[model samples]
Target: MSAFPQPAQPSLFGDDGPLRDTREPVLMSLNPVYYDLIWAGEKTYEFRRRFLTGQSVRWYVYLTGPVGRLGAVIDLGPAVVDAPEQIAEIAERTRAGNGASVFEYVRDLDQAFAIPIQRVAEYPGMPLEQLRTELGGFHPPQGYTRLRNHPDLLSICEKVRADSVRREMTVPGH
Candidate 1:
């Protein structure tokens, strides 16, 4: 038998049908510097070689250690795919100062894409241990994955989304 227990079925739907879940799972192996920059709203775009094409994917940040946990949900704009120089131009137009970093990350690659992101909600995050317990054996994705495909992770993300909504509703201004 497996050492870790499987997750229960996700209660992701209402009587009508599946709830519209816009959030997508993304495991970013980010350094603290980049993480802080993204959180601070200093960085507006995330560089990547590939992203889910022709899809509206809002990234759920799973910040790698030394702060291993689920951090925030960011709605991503369309992936702007082009050659390195072209991508840099787009970044400059968007006023993203991290354009140079994008070039660096895509140095060897002929083409790359940048996903513009705005933080929808930020949280302290679920620790790795807790994540492992919930997911039955969580390993950070080397690249990224769609959370909807992973029942266990999707369930946790759904809770996170619910909590975020609840917190917003309880707030005085919201």
Candidate 2:
């Protein structure tokens, strides 16, 4: 017998249909510093130069550089597109002392996107080396890549999502 018990498989469908029918899955690379803030729940909004609006998105967060791993999945609400200054105002309102740098990042842009973080699920992580080995070769995205475009990556994300679901179900008071 195996030393560890296998986790229960997550159901793909609910009463309506697939559980993830509403949100599109996408892989997004984040700086280790910013990822740390998100992990700590200090960062509530993710500011981007551009992103999909009017729809929810599930972000498979890949921490770049030394970490070089996909460590967490974040469920994001619809993007709030607005002027850079206005986006900065949101950062300042939500979390003090965060607006200045956020403004700096998007100052040159005509419009920016403020993606609200709804939930975060952390996993053990998949390193870059392992990902490259599994998918033949993997290139971390500069912006974002739709999971649908890459079947292998999509499968990996699905497994992570399933694992997260299982973990949540098993947790007390979930």
Candidate 3:
């Protein structure tokens, strides 16, 4: 009776390619300003001081403050770890007006991560209050929390991802 396809049913991407099982998803808190950029497809890379390298990941975006909701999921490519200047170069090459800010953010660190945004899926989000009520007390992560560590949250994300895939499949020319 459920509208969304079950996870174990079949390949959402098609028969030849099953969904690539990336590393466990992470819940990341984002400032509303930057979250808007990401949602609008203006921001191509997410700069991080520390993050898992060598693996792709799905980031469950928790928009902080005025927008206190888990609003979107972003699929990210493997992180590009490099010197601050080098990372800044990537920002400049990809999107204009972000290079200086990116440089400033990573300047103090020896190395930084430039996580490429592969895809983004927006959905009707679970608000913070509702999440806390459902989870019996939830705090948005300051750094990041692996979804696997919280089965409840992981289950929610899985459903959302499945629905997103279904929508993509139904969309013409997807």
Tens digits of per-residue lDDT for model 1, 119-151: 456665677899889878888777887766777
Q: Number of the top candidate by TM-score?
A: 2
Among the numbered candidates, top lDDT falls to 2
Clashing pairs in 3: none
**Candidates' TM-scores?**
0.73, 0.81, 0.78
Sort by TM-score, top down from the best: 2, 3, 1
Q: Candidate 3 at 83: error in angstroms?
A: 0.7
Q: What is the C-alpha RMSD of each candidate to the true structure, in Å?
A: 10.7, 9.2, 7.8
> How does each model score on lDDT?
0.66, 0.82, 0.79
Overall local distance difference test of candidate 1: 0.66
Which stretches of candidate 2 lie above 4 Å from their native place?
1-12, 15-20, 164-174
Encode model 3's per-residue lDDT on 84-130: one tens digit a residue. Answer: 99999988877797899999988999999998887777777788998
List the candidates ranked by lDDT, beginning with the highest. 2, 3, 1
Model 1 vs truth, CA RMSD:
10.7
State the displacement of the C-alpha of residue 17, model 3, in Å, after optimal TM-score superposition. Answer: 9.0
lDDT of 2: 0.82
How many backbone overlaps does candidate 3 show? 0
